[model samples]
Target chain A: MSGATPMLELRGLRKSFGDEVVLDGIDLSVASGEVLVVLGPSGCGKSTLLRCAVGLEPLDSGEVLVDGNLISATARDASLRQRVGMVFQSYDLFPNRTVLGNVTLSPMVVQHRSRSDAEEQAHSLLDRVGLWDKRDSYPSTLSGGQRQRVAICRALAMRPEVLLLDEVTAALDPEMVREVLDVVIDLADGGLTMMIVTHEMRFAEAVADRVVMLDQGHIAETSDDPPAFFRDPATPRARAFLSTFDYRRRSGRASGSLTKE
Target chain B: MGGAEILFQGETISRLLSGLMVTIRISLVSVAISIPVGVVVGIAMSSRHLLVRAVLRAILEFVRVMPQLVLLYVVFFGSATAFGLDLSGEAASVIVFSLWGAAELGDLVRGALASIPPIQYDSAYVLGLSRMQTFVHIILPQALARLMPPTMNLVSRMVKTTSLCMLIGVVELIRVGQQIIDFNRFQYPTGALWVYLAIFVMYFLVCWPLSIASRRLERRWAA
Candidate 1:
């Protein structure tokens, strides 16, 4: 991991909202084509970490590097943004545009792709996510699952080097969650670089090349083998977090099964 | 009241109809000028910088609180007295209404911009849009959709507000109606009521459709 240059790197990242520390001084890196899944309870700053990585949130004092180059948060760097695509939990598709329009927007506007080429890429991506039929549809007309898929297509259409998904399935219905997770699994299988923030243990286990459990704005545990992490977490905090899920699963209260695919 | 009487009412009706045309022309031109200026002001108000937003808000507040008639008077008189600019009543009415319309629509646009969820901005940022691209491609399109109802409502109000231009002696529908009444006060006796009724009907015919359109837009947005 140290020999190869990281595709994405965060060094000494720190963020705060008023006096409440959301992300303490932290360092994280992801190698090329690696899937790093971040896991934590709410308020653990997993989402903030992703946000800061993409320059959506200004860091208090830190640096973010993409493929060994620093990116300025204030500068209007179209290429810098084009390299790091993100999909939100809310599926924030531009409601004013059609599905094709939403997906092709960045490619045409930022990358300066010709309309024909952008639409070509958009069509392929949409087809991959099984949303080709909904190409002309507005976001409001789609199901939760379908909209999330379109959101994924919109990000992938930019052809970024690294993709960040912040709890993409958190807003979906239980039945809808599988379709989105399946897309992530397919992306991971295709060897796309991804950093995902999610609470779905089974999906994370299936897709993550490495799993890091965040606690109180800090990395409490990291495991290269997600299965081992679930079976037996080394850190007490990781164990405690897993145990709550375990208890929930044993009592048949967990909405979805925790079995590894 | 009927088609024959309406069409054959002669010069009094003809003059009033011509005034109606002037009113329509002013209202349309005012809307065209106001909406774009209003959108600019609205976007300025939505700036992330507190200082910029505050300054624009102060100016918009002044415009909002001041009466349109007073603004007309100020622009009509002040330009002449202070700058020695002899602005015609039509030009003065345009300036005053455009200012007022821009401020009202600007506030509406500001509200629409504010109403957009923060996630939209984040999404646009991640997709690699520059600030301007985000606004043009993402923010403005969505905001414009949500802004339609309020904007149309303001346009109708601006149409009605054009009547205030009569105070400055521009020959719009209201002004022409008053002239017709004065001309016919003794000869026709009850002609004043007819002229007033015609003005009322004209204003209603112009504004009622816009109100309906505004409501329709609101319902579509809700859907």
Candidate 2:
């Protein structure tokens, strides 16, 4: 009955979409203030793992616990999604919203925070993401980086126990990628628990306190020091991924260019 | 009022302006009702239930495939006679037009919602938003942005369709023009052409700004 335990725990998580088995039995946990990075190639189930963890996708089997409340179980009772926040690869900004409006929408609407209070919090978060200048501008008007940054603020405004970042920077350009990762790294510095699914080995190596390597829907290996993990992968899948990634890596390695139309 | 001078000369101009007003009235009501109705239907179409989707699909296809005039006659006259309902010409046109608007706008809404990349939805889920939160704050806004241009274009079509209400004996602008020209056949037998031209221009006037807005939005959002 610890009040301040780890924010999330995934035990034997399994999921499938129709006939596609997207997540096999997986086990993972995140302390309230830890930053865990999930790495894998495309279609390897990293994104699916994040979605299942946050209750976005129903799990075929196993349990997803957030702040010790069950989000999904073996019986498929998904109910703990309220405290886990997520950021997607595409930012998922409200196109009908100004940057500030997007940031504060949930708080003012769902949480019933007073408009002034929500605006106050929104402005502060927008300032944190360096988007205050664009607060009045719509998502359709901002650059990719700016919009994604607004998305991050939108996540932080909810005061979630855990934040799930699914390749957020994978859609940004090189320079813009740094801008977003920097925000995430700063959040880590401020003790936000984050489970990030990403391909940015450099960012992973630089920011992750624990690096989890997923391969074909299973956790192949996990290590405490990301630099060590990236430099010396333990599992064959990790080594293979590392080996392949090093040969033809893109220059600048930013996320904005990654989500090219 | 404006185009009659350009398209036709002499004493036939007064009748056309009156006809123009009818076109504007029908379009305004139909367009207003269509917006919210289409949004709800579009969202319903994305529902998971097979029965709901099947019913909505049937309604949409029925509206889409059948001619609007036919729908008008059926919903207006056929249903009214069978159910013993009272509907004036204007009332029938508005009711029929709303249904037509619902089907068309619903599809436009579906496309608008579809245009949003899936990544955005992923973001909302990860942000701990409940399904309703995601729809209101995230999905609805993005959908609304994409919905604007198409709905505007739809307003133009709705405006044009009001001319068809002449068959229903609505005293809208086109009917007014036809009635006037029918009475004043001695002015010129060509008065029918003049009257129709004027009615068309009034529709153009009412729907022109909407078309311009639609074009501007399309250009701004073009890939």
Best by lDDT: 1
Give the C-alpha miss distance for residue B153 in model 2, angstroms.
2.7
- Per-candidate TM-score, chain A: 0.93, 0.89
Candidate 1 residue-wise lDDT, A125-184, digit = tens:
988999999999889889999999999999999999999999999999999999999999
lDDT of 1 at A106: 91
Candidate 1's iRMSD = 1.0
Per-chain TM-score (chain B), model 2: 0.87
Query: For residues B32-89, could you state the per-residue lDDT of candidate 1 as single tens digits?
Result: 9999999999988887999999988898899888888899999999999999999999
Interface quality of candidate 1 as DockQ: 0.71
lDDT of each: 0.88, 0.79
Model 2 Cα lDDT, one tens digit per residue, B77-194: 9867899887877778888888889988888787777777776666655555566777877777767767778888778888887878988787777677767677757656655666
TM-score of each: 0.90, 0.83
Q: Report the lDDT of model 2 for residue B31.
A: 72
Clashes of 2: 14
